[model samples]
Target: MKKHTIVALVQDRPGVLSRVIGLIRRRGFNIESLAVGHSETPGVSRMTIVIEWEDVEQVVKQLYRLIEVLKVSDVTDDPVVEREMTLIKIHAPGPKRPEIVALSEVFDAKIIDVGANTMVIEMTGSPAKVQNFIDVIRPYGIKEMMRTGRIAMVRGVRGHNAEEFVENANGHAERVPVMN
Candidate 1:
């Protein structure tokens, strides 16, 4: 019932993403947000997945069974820096441009482009901040808006690193996060 954010480091190859998605679908887990991109290491990809599931540990274990998946971590409980980017196009005429620009400044949003009657605002922040900005700009007649999937990185020294996934003497896999 609660949302869990799982980050997985997997081999970068064709069909690997589809395979992961298929596995999640077969298990009946609904993905709330999915963001995948290149990882720190070449030929490896990082996937940030948000799903509403209780058995997070089970899911992580299942993911490890997949050959492409190199590491998995449930970052829901970890202290993390989560961010999302949103671009909002608002109907801002000459008279309303100043007011809208001021409002965007208050939220640390940037006015990327301005046309005759519309302006595009770009912002990056937490989900709550993004929602608040949207709420405030709703009255201004939004022309269009788009948002990127959530991306996160754990705080402090302990994080989702390649070194975390270590092979034991017997050749079994184990994760040992370096604790501060």
Candidate 2:
């Protein structure tokens, strides 16, 4: 089995997420991670999903068959930009405060809040980069953690454009403007 990342653009309607998840579960696919949020367009939500699949092509076709799914693309093979967000709270002694701050700076993370004995750090980056930051800060004692799953978009000149996306689905080949 190979790992694949798919970005699904769907109508932001109630029960849509549950229906999509149900399909995946019925197919016996393992979802590694899933993140859903609003897109630049109102009433549209983008779902970023990572899963292990035996055949990516079949999965993509199956997803497209769903009525509510507006667009489905397997971005794992594409040259795309990907990122994740993580928040970590750590117990910091007075003397260790400066050290922790420096580490966060090195990782380009922000110190969101500082208490008398703890500091909350927010970091956004690729998964490996975030894991490296977490590994380095674990020695200082992590008190809590929260993470937003991975989100991605295709990169460069060949990225999907809104009109092109619609036309492609409609058996037309005209270029269309990209929608965020």
Candidate 3:
């Protein structure tokens, strides 16, 4: 199973995300990570999803079938920079606090919150780095942990222009222009 990252632009309406996730679930695609947020263009949203799939074309076609889906691009093969952020609250008191802070410095992570018994460390980097940091600090006893799904953008060339995404879908050009 190969991992694939797909970026999708969809109408910023209610129930859109749920429908996309439901479709993937129904198709038995293993979703590795999913992140959605408002895009530069108003009334449009960008979703970055990582899934384990052998047939990427099929997934793209299925996504295009949704009326709310404006554009879909398989960025997995593109030269893209991907990042994920994690916030981990670990047990750190007295001596342990210094040790945890020192370990975080190696990764350039910051101590966002400090308490008497725990401290929250924020780390942002590639998924591997974030996971490794968490693993190393696991022994310190994780009180709470949260991770934002990976977000990616291809290197070189603007992915969007004038609120328009021009891409060939199904042997024809699909130009989705988000209204201003």
**TM-score of every model?**
0.86, 0.87, 0.88
Please give, for residues 95-134, the per-residue lDDT of candidate 3 as tens digits. 8887898999999899998888989999999998999999
For each candidate in the order shown, give its overall lDDT on alpha carbons: 0.86, 0.84, 0.86
Clashes of each: 0, 0, 0
lDDT of 1: 0.86
For candidate 1, lDDT tens digit of each residue in 135-180? 9988999999998878889999978866655556654445566687
- Provide the lDDT at 31 for model 1: 90
11-115: candidate 2 lDDT, tens digit per residue: 677898998888889988778889999766555678999999878787778878887777788999899988999999999989999999999999999999999
Model 2 off-target regions past 4 Å?
161-180
TM-score of 3: 0.88
Residue 3 C-alpha lDDT in model 2: 81
A best-first ranking of the candidates according to their TM-score comes to 3, 2, 1
lDDT winner, 2 or 3 = 3
Q: Pick by TM-score: which candidate is best?
A: 3
Angstrom error of the Cα, residue 170, model 1: value is 26
